[model samples]
Target: MKGNTNKIIWLTGASSGIGEALAYELSHKGYKLIISARNEKQLILVKEKCKYPENVAVLPLDLAGFSTVGNGVKIAIAIYGRIDILINNAGISQRSLIMETGLEVYEKLIIVNYLGTVALTKEVLPHFISKKSGQFVTVTSLMGKFGSPYRSGYCAAKHALHGFFDVLRMEHDKDGIDVTLVCPGFVQTKVAINALIGDGSSQNRNDTATEQGMPAEIFARKMIRAIEQKKYEVYIGGKEIKGIYLKRFFPNLLHKIVLRSQYR
Candidate 1:
């Protein structure tokens, strides 16, 4: 594994879950981290927990506020001089039927999950290109590869990220830019509680499988390893993560299996 010592990393959604865990893990490993999230308090807590607290910088940010990300990027770059990696881990989930979900609900999901990520990535592209070296690590979900019931909009946003970032990799590969798309099936995070409901309100409740999902710290470790190897795409999670392959190789069989699966 390549040690990330001295590498400048910009991580979004660092308030909790995998982002927070990754902040500590990477900082401990000697990476200079600039962590961002909407919750400044939680971001500070993440920094405080780092084994190398001085290596972590908390830059609280709201991805939904696309216009302000440029300023955030500027501040991060000013602090670190150059960013070697950008981890787009900030996103919200949805748990509502297509018909039951309001138009506003769909808009909010797409705007925050897809548009916000795209805006921030665009903001940092010039710097990466000029440096002729950088990595874009995105934390998409299994929903990105296969759609399930009650996650119509969430699926759309994740799928769009693949389309956009795949092209980015193709176009910038020669420029020393690397893109790693991480699709995890599920991990014990507050994703379900923060998920948007039919009326666009937070679910504020945990789902069955998610409650027993993989630990965020372990997920972050695997993610970092994948990023170090520059894998174009990697799936991290439990048995359910294999569905990505089953869906591709045996669509009909996967359909039947998923139909009987409890996750849906």
Candidate 2:
């Protein structure tokens, strides 16, 4: 699907941050887009800002509420006849230690970050299988590759995404199904401010590293290139991208460095 301007892309979490930037970029490239988020109003605002506002459709979705996902998928397909790509970008972050976090917090994390994405994917899987061509671009985090402080549940959910999508690529390669796992280290966004804390409430604060990380627009550009190339996976960020290699070849050293780092 590289260089295909007619492709239809359904992007979640399009109301803000990286997703918003991606919507703008993709729409500018002449691709039809269906932007989704829990807030329909914000989704509309984002659509208006796109290069081709008339080509952008807003579909509000609640990832935590999986029961409505099937119908949502149906509506998404109807919007553009079929979706060429599904960008799984909707997920919540965590900013609490495991010891103090509530069970419900972890449950919400898994539901929104893992189960919700899986449910949506399952709903769309049959269509892909029928057509024998589709793409799933999941916006996981660098935490998916390794650990970090104040993000135990977030890390677990992201790591789960890697596992699930990896197997998906393996099982559906023959069907022409493509899975691209995008791991982002730190992007200047509201993710940290919206992160859940021990009491199941938003952290409501910005993170130092996140504020200083790469711009969401820049990350979006790189991410789209990777998607166009149909890469199996790609990591986007500043120096923090090195953590992936550090974890792979120097586990103990990475662990020590993580403990001493101030990013959390």
Query: What does the lDDT read for residue 81 in candidate 2?
Result: 95
TM-score of 1: 0.97
| lDDT score, candidate 1 | 0.91
What residue pairs are clashing in model 2? none
Give the per-residue lDDT digits (tens) of candidate 2, residues 179-216: 99999989999999999999999999999999999999
- Residues 208-261 of candidate 1 have per-residue lDDT tens digits of 888899998899899999999999999999999878988899888878887787
lDDT at 145 for candidate 2? 95
User: Would you list the clashing residue pairs of candidate 1?
Assistant: none
TM-score quality measure for candidate 2: 0.98
CA lDDT of each candidate? Answer: 0.91, 0.94
